[model samples]
Target: MSVAATRRLNLVTEPILPRIRPAIAALAPYKQGKQAGPDAFKLSSNENPFEPLPSVLEALQRTAPINRYPDATASRLRARLGVRYGVNVEQVHVASGSVSILQQLILATAAAGDEVIYAWRSFEAYPSLPLVAGATGVQVPLTADARHDLNAMADAVTDNTRAIILCTPNNPTGPIITSAEFTAFVERVPADVLVILDEAYAEFVTVPDAVDGLAERVYEKHPNVVVLRTFSKAYGLAGLRVGYAIGHEKVLDSARTTGIPLSVTSAAENAGIASLDAEAELLERVAVIVERRTRLLEGLRAAGWDVPDSQANFVWLPTGERTDEIAAAFVANDLVVRPFSGDGIRISVGEEASIDRVISVATSVR
Candidate 1:
């Protein structure tokens, strides 16, 4: 970028707004995935293609009056999740969504001068969350194949490190961190530092050996560890905003202390419980998306794109410097995509009809 037209993501050259922290002023608010035109498929956000489950709707309809405050503790939902994860109710924490919980955890553990580590080009939220806590973010670059570099991440740890976030079946890239890889990486981390396993898309992952934070009970062995899960993706509850965490009781208590009170509504809590009751049907829907993802991955590779083998409901296209150009083509063809300039495009596995158009656009560009 030319100096005259230069805009830095964090470089501060101008006067700060009155009463604003320089750190906060240097950053911009997060931008959501681009919205598509009415006739176009919104393939930018990795949302579930299936409609909301009947159970969730029924639960919402039966919700109590809105005048009264919701159960701030989300007691019933926490109990249900606790039983599902084979842990005590104290081990489960519910919030608006996993991202809210992530922010809460960052606030609880990190502060000025502390360092928080995560793999870059993984999750868009990871880099920005630490900034909110006044902590410096240490971005470890992903491997050439678009997976986390766990070894390098472990080496990046220092005495000032306060927390580390691991996104399995990572967003955009869609590659999972294996169980073996997580275990070895945790061994290198200090016991006092926090390790957050953000498994927001765990329901979509198909690999047998991928990291299972709750099933394996990594927290039982590593008390500093916390696993985050969300209903937004698989349960079609993105609009409802419900997510939960499973781990050590004390660690969750700390997160709760830092959370915004009454953020999880009664409607959201009821829907989460109903979704859990209807998990079998939801898994069936997930199976369909998994097949769609497989088809999309195969077609992209057949079109000569260097796409990653995604276990989640999305695929990555390494369009390099042509990212903007290729993404524009997809948009022109009515398939909105998320593009990171100079890096790649992440197209969500959307409606069945969007599959061919995505591939067709890439083929034409190539």
Candidate 2:
């Protein structure tokens, strides 16, 4: 942060962004935790604590020639997913992660001067995707308790609004919008404007009122609706990077066309199919995560810290200005928790030992 340090950092001689697309230049690089090293206990990216199931590992081992091109259509994975979800194969499109799929959707639908709406504290990808697609972003403030103010978001719609991203059990704050709320909001949104329900953490949520009927809601009722999901979280396959989106065939077609790399890698495709087959095993891991999340919430609260009722695999520390201090303390203890603007620290629920480290560090904070 010193001028001398800044000067040292400025040694690169490319005019910072020389000749890059203006849109690309405008993006500050995405920050993730430091990769493996002696001091790394990364609980930053909200990955599941469990390793890939035995079936998934076996599938990977049995996979044939890596040099050969993958199935362009990802036919086997698509067929399995479609059958499992009771939807037509055309309705589902797979990508590296939900992030890629999201980018493709924005590129397909948004253009210069158009507006894309999402909650202020929702997925970090929401803002970047719209901007990268050459559209303006409309960030609505969260409600009093850190939940999406769906009514206000609906009111933000304008003639130029092309899409709205609703991140359920919202990242860093795990509150889900009710089905009634979504229904009401959907009714108000224009038919031409796409409404994306990002359910990356869907498996972690246990609320009765929470909406998990994303496939049905999007594919059956609303032509403009798109649902994004991932195998990274509950399925324990973040490294494999397989995610999917379900929408009307036409909307899915647009994403397929715009998405890079043609399809998810064959390894990821095979892993996804194997993951589906291990649903029971994955659900058991999910149950453990839910239990651990409960313990984390209760422990944090009992230690006199204010925390939200989380339905996701992570807990939010909404202490605003204290975030830096907390994150520093965590780092000192060899744990890495994500810090956001104001006083937010998102700590992923990991194994008991990792959770204990977080609790210990948090409790030691003055």
What are the per-model numbers of colliding residue pairs? 0, 2
lDDT of 2 by residue, 1-366 (tens): 999998877886445545777877878877775553465677888988677777899999867578888887787888898898888999888888888888889999899999999997877777788888888999999987889999999999999999999988899788898888888889999899999898999999988888775634654887899998999898988998889988898999999899876457888888899899889988998999999999889889888887877888899888688878878888888887788857598889987788777887888894
- The alpha-carbon deviation from the true structure for residue 188 of candidate 1, after best TM-score superposition, in angstroms, is 1.1
Give a tens-digit lDDT track for model 1, residues 1-366: 676556563376765657988888888788789998989999888889888887779999988799999999999999999888788899999999999999999999999999999998888988888899999999999999999999999999999999999998888799999999999999999999999999988999888999999889999999999999999998889988999999888888889999999999999999999999999999999998888889888888998988987887789999999999999999899999999899999999889898888888888998
C-alpha root-mean-square deviation, each candidate:
6.2, 5.0
Worst 10 residues of 1 by lDDT: 3-12
Local error of candidate 2 at residue 301 (angstroms):
1.2
TM-score of 1: 0.94
lDDT of 1 at 30: 81
Look at candidate 2 and give me any clashing residue pairs: 320-342, 320-343
Q: What is the lDDT of candidate 2?
A: 0.85
Best by lDDT: 1
Q: C-alpha displacement of 169 in model 2, angstroms?
A: 1.3
Q: For each candidate in the order shown, give its overall lDDT on alpha carbons.
A: 0.91, 0.85
